[model samples]
Target chain A: MNAPPITTASAESPALPNRFDLTAAIKDGLKTALIMLGLSIPILAYKTDQSGGDLWLSPRWGLVAILCALVFGLRILLHAFMATKAAREATPSPHQATEFVHAEPNAFQKTSRFAIPFFLGVALAFPVIIYFIQGGLNESRYWVDLGILILTYVMLGWGLNIVVGLAGLLDLGYVAFYAVGAYSYALLSTTFGLSFWICLPLAGILAGFWGMILGFPVLRLRGDYLAIVTLAFGEIIRLVLINWTDLTNGGAGISSIPRATFFGLPFTSGEGGFAQTFGLEFNGMHRIIFLYYLILALALLTNFVTMRLRKLPVGRAWEALREDEIACRSLGINTTNVKLTAFAIGAMFGGFAGSFFAVRQGFVSPESFNFLESAIILAIVVLGGMGSQIGVAIAAIVLVGGPEILRNLTFLQAVFGSGFDPNEYRLLLFGAGMVAMMVWRPRGLISERSPTVILKERKAISGSLVKEGHG
Target chain B: MRWIQDPLLDVQHLTMRFGGLVAINDLSFKVGRGDITALIGPNGAGKTTVFNCITGFYKPTEGLIAMRKPDGSNLLLERLPGNSINWKAKVARTFQNIRLFSGMTLLENLLVAQHNPLMLSSGYTFLGILGLGGYRTAEKEAIEKAKFWLEKTRLIDRADDPAGDLPYGDQRRLEIARAMCTDPLLLCLDEPAAGLNPRESLELNNLLLSIRKDHGTSLLLIEHDMSVVMEISDHVVVLDYGTKIADGTPSEVKSDPRVIAAYLGVDDEEVEQVEAEIGV
Candidate 1:
C-alpha cells in the first residue's frame, strides 16, 4: 500500500487510484474472525440446562464456526467496498458536479412536509376506519385498543419532548408527573365524586404544581446531577404511592375509578347514554370510539401548544437556555423561572395524559408509574429526534405499536416452538434496533432543524449544529 | 479625550477574593456617561474579574459597585441579583470566548436578547401562545429592532444562518449585535477584537464608536489590541495584580510609568531603562 502510493506520487501524474490490497484485506478479515471466534465461544458455543438435580450440556460449535466464517467473509467484502468508494472520491469530477450554488429543498424536507398531515389524517379517521374494516365496534375491539395504547404513548412522548427535547433538560423522572396526574384524577373523582371533566383540569394543575416543586430544588443543577435528582424525585413519588395506604390504597391499587364521560352524555345501555341520545343501536364501541377520539385530541393539544410556544419569547428563552445559560442570563432572561416554566408546562401535559390513562383503565396504581416507563418515554423523545414533533409521533408508533403487533403474531409460536413467546424477545430486538439507530442516524429520524422564529426566509440547518450533547 | 465628571458608573473599593488568591483587590474606577472606557491589563491582571463583578456573575467580597442615572438615582450593581444586572439594570455584556447561541440564527440571537420586554407583553408566555394582537405587535417591533442591529452589523443577508456557522469576524460582530439588542445602558465587551484581522478590527472600533455616539450607551471593554483600545477609548483604566495602577485619559494611561513597568515585566526603578531600550 505504501509503495504504490509513493511511486504514483513521484511520477508527477498520480492518475491511477490506490488499488485495493488483497493481503491487507485478508489480514483485516482474519482479525475480525478472531474477535468473533472469541465472542461466539462463550455466548453461542455451549448451553447448559439442569433438570431435577441432573445437568445436560448442549454443544453448538458448528453454529459458532459458521458465524465466525460469515463475519470473516463480510469483513473482506466491506473492505473492498470502502476501497472502491475512496478511489471514486479521490477522482475529482467536474466543478459543476460538486459545486452547489445554493441549497435546494432536500428529499427529507419534501417528504416531511407530506408525512405530517398524512399521518394526522390517518390518526383522525382511525376509529372510523377500524369500524368499517372490522365490520362493527364489537369485532374491532383489539385494533381500537391498540390505537388507544399508541396514542397514549404518543401523548406521553410529546409531553416529555418539551423538557428533554426543547429546553434541553435531561429529566429521567418525567413519569412521576404522569403518576401525579393519574393519582390526582383517581383520588379526586373517587373520593369527592367530581366529574371527569372537572377533575381533568384539576389533575393537570396539581401535576403542574408538583412539577414546580420538583423544579425549584433542581434549578441549580445541570446535566447528570439534574437527571439524578429528577430520577430520585420520581422514585420518591412512586414509593409514597405504595406506602401511603390511606390515599393510594397501598399495593392493592384504586379500582372502579369514574369513567371518562362523553361531555355530559354517558356510554351506558340505558336511556340518556351516548348511543341512546343519538338513537343509534346500542353498542359497546361508542365508548371505545370516544376514548380513541379523546386521546387523539389530547395529544394534538399537547403538540399545538408546544409548537405555538416555540414561537413565543418564553419559548425562545428555553432554546436559548439550552444553547448557553450564561448567554441567556446576559440577555436579561430569568433562567430560573424559564426552567421552572418548562417543568410546569411539560408536567402539566404529562398530567393530562395521565388522567386520560386513569379514565381509560378505571384503575390507578404504583405499578403503572415506574422508572422503566420513564426510561421508555425518554427513549421515545430522544429516538424521535429531539424538538421534532413528527419524529416523536413516528417513534411512538414504532416503539409502542411494534411490540403490540408482535403480541398478535401467533405464527411465531408455531415456527419457533409451542412454548416459545415472541414477546420474550421484544426487548432484545428493541436493544438491537436502538443500537442500529444510534450508529446509523444518531440525531433520530428527522434531524433537520429550522428556526422557530424566522426573520427572513426560513432555511434548513443540520440538527447536530445546535444539539445539546449533555444528555 | 472628551469625558464627563459625573460618572455613569462608580466602583468604590471593589474587592473580590477567591480563597487566598484575590482575583480583584480593593480596586476602584468610574465610567463616564456616553464614553468608552478601556480596561487594559496583562494576563492574570483581573480585567475580566472586574467585568464578572459588574455583570453580577460574581459577588465581590467587599465593595460598592454602583450605576448612576442623570436623575440622581443609582443602582448598587454588586447588590443586584442574578440576571437582574442585565434585565433590570440594563448592563449587557459579551464574553472573552464567544458565547452566541450557536444553534440559533443571527436574528434569533438578537430577539432573545430583547427577552425582558417581550416576556412581559407576551403575558409570561400564555397570551403569546394565544396569538393575541398585542403580543404579535410587540414581537413584530422586537423583530424590527433586531433587524436594525443586523443591518448595522452587515449581517442581515444571512440572518437565518446558524451563529456557529459564521466566519470568525462575523461571530464577534454578532455577539455585540446581540448585546446591543437589549437596548443596554452599558455594554461590556471582553476582547472584542482579540481574533479579528486588522481590517475587521478597524470596523469593530467604528461600530463601538457609533454605538457611543448615536445611542449614548457607555461601553467598557478589555482589549490587548492597542490600535482598538487607543483609537476609540475616552477613558482608560489599567490594572496589575488585581489592583488599579493607572486611571485617566488613554494618552496619559499609555505613558504611565507603573503601567509600562507592569506590562513590560520590569521593576518601577528599571521602567525608564526598559522604555529607553524599547524606544517607546
Candidate 2:
C-alpha cells in the first residue's frame, strides 16, 4: 500500500522531483482566494448604515479586499503547514488510527466531587457577594440582573436536558413551550386579573400541554427528522404569536403586566405595599432582591426535581430509551408514555422559567422567545454534559455570563482602536468559543455520569460508556 | 407438572413475508414446557424469523401463535404488541447481536428488567420520586432480585461496571441474567454461543442447564454451533429453506437422512451413507 502511493505520487509529478510543490501551493491559494471573494462580496462589500434616521447601503470595497487577502494568505499557510507535517510523519503507525481520541479522566474531571458543591456555594452567595463588592445596591443592580438572567438560562438548560439529554428526543422547538408559558401567564393575568402566583402553575400546565401536542405528531420521528419537525413547531408558534393581533397584541407586546409581589404584597411605594408594610426605606432594591431570590429558588427547584427523578424507574426508562430505543421497547418499557412524560416535564420547567422572565421584565414579547433562545438553551445542554445538572449551570454561566461580562472590558477598545466595542463582536466570539470548546472537549465539559442506580457503592461512569443515542 | 401435557408455545402454519420475500413459509413447531429446544438451520433459513414470530417482534402474516399462560389461558401472540408479549405474556428474548443496555451498570440493566413491577409498586413514578416507604420497599426488593441474577451469572463483583465494559462471554451471560430477572416464562436466546470459545461454550452450557433444571424456565434457542446443539438440546428441530425438515431427539436428529442432507448440502441418498460412515 505504501509503495503504490509513493509510485503514483512520483509518476504524477515528475517535474517537482524534490516534492517541494510551490505551484500546487499557489494554485490552492488562488482557488481559496477566488472562493472567498465570491462568498464575502455581498456580505462584506456592502454594509447597512443608519445616519440621522436615514438608512442607506455603504460600500466597503477596501475592507472586503483586505479580508479576502487575509483569508487567501491564511489558507496557503495552513496548507503548507499540513503538507510539511504530513511529509515529516510519512510512515504513519497503524496504532495511531485505532487509538482512542481521549485518555483516562483528567485531574479536573476526577475532582468533580468537590467542584459541584463549590459551584453551588458560589451560586448561592453570588448576589450578596456582588452587593458587598460594589459597595451599594444601586451599583450592584446590574450584576444582580445578569445573575438572574444566567440562572434563568441554567434552569431552562436543565429543563430541556430531560427531553433532549436524557430521553434523546432532539427537541429543537423547546422555546415553543417557553413561549406558550409566557403567553399563558400574560393572557391570564391581563384578561382575568390573576396574580403571578396563580398564573405560574397555570402557565406551566399550558406549556406542558403544548409540549404533548407537539410530541404526539413527532412520536415516530427520530434524529434529524425529529429536529426539523421541532424547529418547524417552534417557528409556527412564533408566527402565530406575531400574526394573532387579538390575543398576543401582534408584536406590539404586552406592557405593565404586573410585577411579582411578595406573595400578595405589591412592591409599591404607596400604602399597604411591601416596603411600607415591612417598614423599611422604600427603595427599588427590595423588589430586585426578591426577584433574584425567586429565580434562584426556581432554578434550585429544577435541579432538585431532576436529581430526585433520576433515581426513579421512569428516569431509568428515559435513559434506557436514550441509549437504545429498540432495546428499551424490547424491555417492555411503555415508550410512548416515557417520551410524552419527558416532553411534558421538560416543558413544564421551561414554562416556569418563561413566566419568571415575564415577571422579571414586567413585559411579554415574542422577541424574547425566538429560535435564538432555543439555540442558546440547546447549546448550553450540549456544552454541559447532556444529562448533568451542574454541568448545565456552569455552562450557562460561562456561555451566557461570559458574553455579558465581556461588555465591561474597556481595555479592548484601547487595544483595537477607540471605536472597537467588545459587545459588537459578541456573537462572533460566541461562535469561536463554541468551536474551540468542541475541539477541546467533544463529549462535553462534565461528561461523566453518576449512575442513577448503583450497586453497594455509587461510582461515576465515564461518558465513553454512555450512549448519546442513535435516534 | 400439569403444563407437561401441553406445549408452552404452539405455532400453527406461521408465515411471515416482507413485500414479495417470504422469510418464513408454512412453519409449524412447538416448544415443550421446562425443556431446552434447539432450532438449527443454515444461514438465511429464517430461524431468527421463527424466533421473532414467537416472541412477538414480528407479527406473522399467517399464523396462530398460542402461548399457554399459567392459568391455562391462550394468548394470541400475533395480535398482541411486542412489549405485551414480554410484560404480560412473560415471553422474554435475547437478540442475535447482544442488546444489553450498554451504558447502564450490570445491576442497573437487571433492575430495569423489573421495571413493570417497580413502576406498579411506585404508583407510576409518583411514589417513587417522593421516596415513599412503599417505593423504597419495592426498590429494595428489585435490587435483591437483580443481585440474585448477577450472582447466578457470576457477575456480582462487576455489578457496578457498565454492561458494555464486560467481556463478550460475560455479556452473553449478563443478557440471560437480565432476562431471568424479568421472571420470564419462556426465554428465547438467538445465537447465544455464536462467538464463544470452547471454554466459554462449556460455561454457557452449564448456565443454560442450570437455568432449565433449577428455575424450570422453558428455553427456545436458535443456534448454529452443532456441538452445542447436539450436547444440550432435549428436542432438536432442523430447518432448511424456511421449512422444518426434521424434529426429534438429539440422537434421532443426528441420524435423520434429511437433517444430514440439509447440513452437509448432499442429496437424500448420499445422506444415509454419510451418516452411516460418521456412525451417528
Candidate 3:
C-alpha cells in the first residue's frame, strides 16, 4: 500500500464541507464514458488477425463494456475527491498551518531515527531471514540474488541522485560510466589477472575519467541541450561496445571473466576454498550471502559518503549551482569545477556498482549497461524527492523490490479472467503511479527538505519552494 | 569633477556589444573605497549591463576595469574570469532578480559564499570526507561570519528557514547577507529595494549604511528609487542611452538638468538640448 503523502491534509480534510451534486457527477461520468467509447471501439472491441491471406475481426464487446464502466465509475469518484480537496483548501485554517509548520521538522527527525536503524538491521539480516523463511538454501538463493539486485539499484539510485537531485544536472548517460567501469574491471582482471579489490578503485578512477571527458564538452549546455547530449553520449558508448570487436569481444560478451574472491580466498568447494577454510559443508549459499553483503556494504559506503559530502563545501556548492549558477559565480564558486566534480563523483559510484555487477555475474557485456538502466536510476532519484537521501533509499526499495512482490499476485489472475496476467499489469501500474505522483505531489514522495545546518532549531522547508532543476 | 578619494575600482572605456547591438558603450566610472556609489538611470539605459561588466558576468569588448586590492596591487577585472573577480579581487554582487538558494536554509546560503576558503581547508572535499582535513575549523569560522551577517541583516531568527520562504524584504536582506559572507572589498547591488515597501526599504537603507560603516566595504548599486539614490549615495552616476551624463556628488547630480531630463523624459528636440548641456 502507498504511504499517505499529505499528513497535514489528512488531519484537516474531514473538517471541510463535503458536498456532491448527483446530476453534475453523472454528467462528468457520461462525458468520460463517451470518450472511452471512442477510444475502445477500434482497439479493445476487436482483435485483428490475418489468416490464409484473409483479414478477420473477432469482437470482444464485453472487454470494452467493462473498461468503459470502470472509467465512468472512477471518474465520478475522482470528481468528488477533487471537490472535497478544493473545499478543504478554500477554508483558511491559519492555526492548522502554523502547527503543521512547527511540527514537520521534529517529525522528520523522529521518523529517521527509527527508520535508518530499522533499514540497516533489515538489510544486514535479509539473506539469513530469507534462508530461514524459505526453509533451505536452494529455495532462498533466488531471493538472495534478488536482494543483491535491489541493492545494486539502490547504489545506482544514490549515485545518480548526486548529479540529478543535488547538483541539478540532467545526465541521461550515467550508464556509460557504469559500462566504462564494468569493461575496465573485466579487461583489467582478465588481461592482467588483477584482483577484484585491486581493480575496483582503478575501475572507479577510469569511470571518473570518462565522466570528465563527457563533462568537458557539455559544460556550457543545460536543461534540454544537456539531456540530449548526455543521451547521445550513452548511445555512443553502447555503439562502441557493440562494434569494437577487438577490445570488447563485440556484444557476444566476455564470460568466465572472474568471480569475486573473499579477500584472495575463492568460494570454491575444493581445498583452501571458503567452505574448506570454515570447516563447513560445501554449499553455494555462502557465495550468494557474501555477494549480498558485499553489495550492501558498498551501497552503505555510497550513502555514507553522500551524506558526508552534503555537509561539505563542495556539496553546498553543487546545491547552490542548482539554484543559480550566476549567483554561485558571484559568490566565488568556480562553477565549472563544481559541476565537473559532481559528474566525476557521481560517475565514480556508478563505476563501483558496475564492477560489482560484473564480479557478481562473473561476466561482462554491453547489453548489461543501457539507457534503460540510467532512466530507472534517474526515476528513482526524482521519485524520492530530488535532494532527499533517505527518500532515495525508500524509492529504490519500492521500485526495485515492488516488482518481486508483483510476481506473487496470482490471486489477481483468479479475480480478473484467466487472460489477465499480473505481470503485464506492472507496467500499467508504473505508468499510473507516475502520473498520480506528478499530479498530487510533483516534488516527490518525501519533498520537504531538512536543513543541514541550523543556528537555532531545525525547520522543514516546503517542497513548493524547491526547484527540481531544469537540466 | 573631482577625483574619487582612495578609489577602489576604476572602470574605463567599457564597451559591450551583442553582435551589432551595443548594450554599454564606452562607459567609465570610479567607485571610492568605503563609500556608497549609486548608478541611477532610466529603463534600458544599460545600468545592469555596466554592473554585469564590472562583476565579470559579461566580457566587455574594450575596457580597463581595474580593482585595487588591499595590498595596493591593481587587478584588471575585465581580464579576470568569472568568479575570480570575487575570489581574487574580492568584488561581490547581487542580482536584480533575487537568486538565493531558495530551497536551502538561510545559513547554508551564507556558508556557500565562503566556499573559496572552506574548499581549500577541506582539500577540495577529499580530506574532508576522510575527516583528516582542517575543514572543521574553517567551517566554524565560516558559520561565525554567517551568524554575524545574519544578525546584522536581522535574519538570525530564521537562519534555519529556506531562503525562498522569506518575504520579499527579508529575501533582499538575505541576498545582501549572503553576498557579504564572501568578505568582498566592493559589493555591487542591482535594485536591492525594487520590491520592498517603504518601511522595509527604510530598514534596507539602514542595513546598507551599517555594512559600509561597519565593514568598510565599497557599495555600488543600480537603483530606480530616487529616495534611496539621493539619500545614501556618496556619489551618483546618471546614464542615458548607455552614456554617462552626470558624474558627481549626490547633490550635484540631483540638480543636473540632464539627470532630471533622462528620468522625467524630454521631447526629441529637448533631448539634444539636454545632451548639449552635458557637453557630450
Candidate 4:
C-alpha cells in the first residue's frame, strides 16, 4: 500500500504560518457569532411578534443586529492582520513528507490546563459563595442538591473515562453498573435496615462483580462487536430491573425509602434526632449540606485514585492497549487483564456514584439508569478530552450543570417574554457546542500530555518532531 | 565454539497447513545459542511464516518449537500466549513492517520494550500508580536502559522525539533497539534491511553482530538481502516452497547446488548441466 500523506509535518514547518493564526481565530469567532445570531433572530422575532417590522431598525432586533455587526467587523480586522503576517514569511520548497507531528503542548495548552482546574474550583465553590452573599441558607437545599448532581456526574465521568478513554473500549451501556449500585443499595438498605455508608461499598463491590462477568465474554472481541455486547448487557440489566417487579417494585419504583441518617442520628423533628442530639436548631438545609459534602468527598477520592492509576504500569498498559492491542501484546502486556481491570475499575466507580445517587435521592428506579445516562457520561469524557480528569469535570459542568444554571436566568424572560423556556433549547445548544468543539479540536479540549523523560538542549523541540519519528 | 551445545531454539518436524494448502511441510532446523541464523528464500517461500511460528504469532499445525529460557528451562513456544511468549520465554521479535508505536516518543517506545521489568517493579500495586519510591527506582532504571539502547543505536540525540518521526532507516534501527531493550535470549528480525540503503544495511549488520557477540543473543533473521545474510550469518537456512531446501554454514549453503538452482530458476534437465558448468 502507498504511504499515507503526512499532513502534520507540512503544517508544522517553520516556513508555513501556524494554522492557529489570527485568521483562524477570527474565522472561528465569526462562525460562532453567526450561528448565535441566526438562532437569536428567529427566537427574538417570534417572541416580540414583529413579523412585518423592518429587519435592522426594529427595536426587537436592535441588540442582536448590533452584536452580529460588531462580530463581523472584528473578524475582518483580525483576518486582515493575519494575512499581512503570513505574506511576510518566507516559504520553503516542497520536500518528501517524512516528518511526524507528535502532539506537544503549545502556548494554549498551559492555559487550558489552568482553565480546567480553575473552572472546576469555581463551580465547586459556587454554592458556598452564593450562600454567604445572598444569605440563602433558608433555600440552601436547591444549591446543595445541585452540588450533589454535579459531584455524582463528575464521579461517573471519571469511572467511564477508565473504560472508554484509557482502554479505548466504547461502552454505550455503562449505566448498567450505575443501576446495579443503586439497586444494591436500595434492596439491601430497605431489607436489612442498613445505613447508606454500609451499603455504599457493598453496592460498588456488586457492580464490580457484574463488570467482570460481562468482561469475560467480550474479552475475545474488539471494537464494534465488544460495544454491541456491552450495550446488550446494559439492556439486560435494565430489562431485569423492569421485569423483577416483586423486588424492585417495577415501574412504580420504591418510594418512602428510608432517608440516610447522619451516623445513628436521624435528621427529623423528633426529640432524639440529629438537631436535638447536637443541640442545634432544626433545619432541612443541614441535611442537604451533609449530603453535598459526602458526595464531594467521594468525587474527589475517585479523581485522586484515577489520576494515580494513570501513572501506573496498569494505566500505561491500558493506554498501549488503546493505541494498538497487537503491539501491546507483543510488549508482554496481558490485554485480557488490562481489559478486565479497566472494566472493573470503571464499574466500581460507577457503583460508588450510583449508591451515592440512591442515598442522596432516597430512591432507586430503572428509569434513572437508561441509555441517556450512558450517552451523557460518554459525552462528558469525550467533550472534556478523553482520559482527562479536569476535562471530564468541565464537560459535566457545561453540559449538565450549565442547563440547570440557566433556569435561574430571570433576565432572559424580559427579552423572550414568559412564554420562552431556555431549558428547552439547552440541549440543542449543548449538541451544537459538542459538534463545534469536535470540528475545532478532534483531540478534545485538552489532549493528553506525554510523560516527559528527556529534557532537550534546543528550545524544547515541537512535539511534531517526535511525532514524525525524529526521536 | 559453543555450536556443539544444544540449539537454543529447536524446531522439529515443523509443518503448517492453511486449509488445503501446505505452507510448510516438515521443516526442521536448530538455531544455536549465540549464533546468527539467517533464513533466506524466494517470494512466497514462507520464511516469515517460520519466524511467525517461532515467535508464537502463529501456531504450527504440527511440530515442536522448544526455546531455551535464560533460566535454563525449555519453553514450548506454540503453547504460550503471544504476550507471555515475549515475557516468560524471553524471545523478542521485530516485524518486517516497522511496528514502533508511532504516536509514542523514542524513549517511550524503548520503555515499552522493558514492559516486563517495569511490571515486576510495580508489583501491580497502588503505590506504583503514585510513582512511589519503588516505582521511581524502576522508572529510573527503565530510562537508563532506554538511554543505553538509544545511544547504542545512535539515537540518543533524538531520545525525546517521536518514534514515527524518524527517517525510514532510523525507524528500522529503532525497532531493533526496542527489541533488544527487552533483553531477550532470542531476537527474531524479519527483513531488517528490506528498505534500507547500503549504508543503513551495513549499520544493521554491525548492530546484529554486536547483539550476537556483546549481548550473547541468538538471532533468527529472515532476510532477502543476500549481502547481509552472507556477511553476518554464521549459519544459513534456505526455504523454498515452504520446505527447507538447504541448511549449513554460510560457505556451504552458498555453494549448494539446490540453493543456486532455486535462485537461478534452473529446469530439472538443466540443473545437472548448470552444476557441471559451475563445477559444484
DockQ of each: 0.64, 0.50, 0.67, 0.40
Q: In candidate 4, what are the lDDT values of residues A172-244, reduced to their tens digit? A: 8899999999888888888898888889899999999998998899888776788788889998999999999
What lDDT is reached at residue B257 by model 2? 72
Error of 4 at A468 (Å): 18
Task: Rank all candidate structures by their TM-score, best first, as comma-separated numbers.
Answer: 1, 3, 2, 4
lDDT of 2 by residue, B1-280 (tens): 2224668988889988999999888988888888788999889999999988887778899979999986899998899887788898888889889998887888888878887888898889887777774988889899998888988889998888788778888999998998888888899999999899999998899999999888889899999988888899888888888888888788998987777677778865677777786665
- The digit string of per-residue lDDT tens for model 3 on A51-78 reads 9999999999999999999999999999
Q: What range of 10 consecutive residues in model 1 chain A has the weakest lDDT sum?
A: A96-105
Q: Is candidate 3 or candidate 4 better by TM-score?
A: 3
User: Which regions of candidate 1 are displaced past 4 Å?
Assistant: A1-20, A31-65, A81-105, A409-421, A469-471, B1-4, B267-280
Candidate 4 docking quality: incorrect, acceptable, medium or high: acceptable
| lDDT comparing candidate 1 with the true structure | 0.89
- Candidate 4 wrongly placed segments (more than 4 Å): A1-103, A116-120, A263-265, A269-273, A276-279, A416-418, A452-471, B1-4, B70-72, B126-133, B267-280
Task: lDDT for model 2, please.
Answer: 0.86
Q: Give the worst 10-residue stretch by lDDT in candidate 2 chain A.
A: A11-20
Give me the TM-scores of chain B across the candidates: 0.94, 0.93, 0.95, 0.94
TM-score of chain A of 3: 0.88
Q: Which residue pairs in candidate 2 have backbone atoms (N, alpha carbon, C) closer than 3 angstroms, thus clashing? A: none
Error of 3 at B263 (Å): 2.1
Give the TM-score of each candidate.
0.92, 0.87, 0.92, 0.83
The CAPRI class of candidate 2 is medium
On lDDT, the stronger of 2 and 4 is 2
In terms of lDDT, the poorest run of 10 residues in model 4 chain A is A462-471
